[model samples]
Target: MREIDVFIDTEEIADFFYQELIKRGFIPAEDEIRELADITFEYLLKKDIIAEEWDE
Candidate 1:
């Protein structure tokens, strides 16, 4: 288990986060983008895929 402080209002997070992750063909809708990001973060958390402090 690990802990850290994060700052961001997901609602106001620069919009279309997942879409911007790659300059792909289709742009995902705002809601779909948020959902994709949420699901990805949850999966990473469960898999312990987070980066180590030294990574930064």
Candidate 2:
């Protein structure tokens, strides 16, 4: 965990990855996204502003 707020670069790279994922037909369907939302939340548990119990 880096204590640096590189939001600008983060957003830029996130957009790039998002577009690449969409292009690869790897875009998650709405239902799948909903399902994976829990996984994403678990990941966020290791991050600040979202520190929840990651252990299932």
Best by lDDT: 1
Model 1 worst lDDT run, 10 consecutive residues: 5-14
| Per-candidate TM-score against the hidden true structure | 0.48, 0.35
Total backbone collisions, model 2? 0
Q: Write the per-residue lDDT of candidate 2 for residues 1-56, one digit (tens) a residue.
A: 56543222334445555666689889755555544555555566556445433336
Candidate 2 lDDT for residue 20: 64
Evaluated against the true structure, the overall lDDT of model 2 is: 0.52
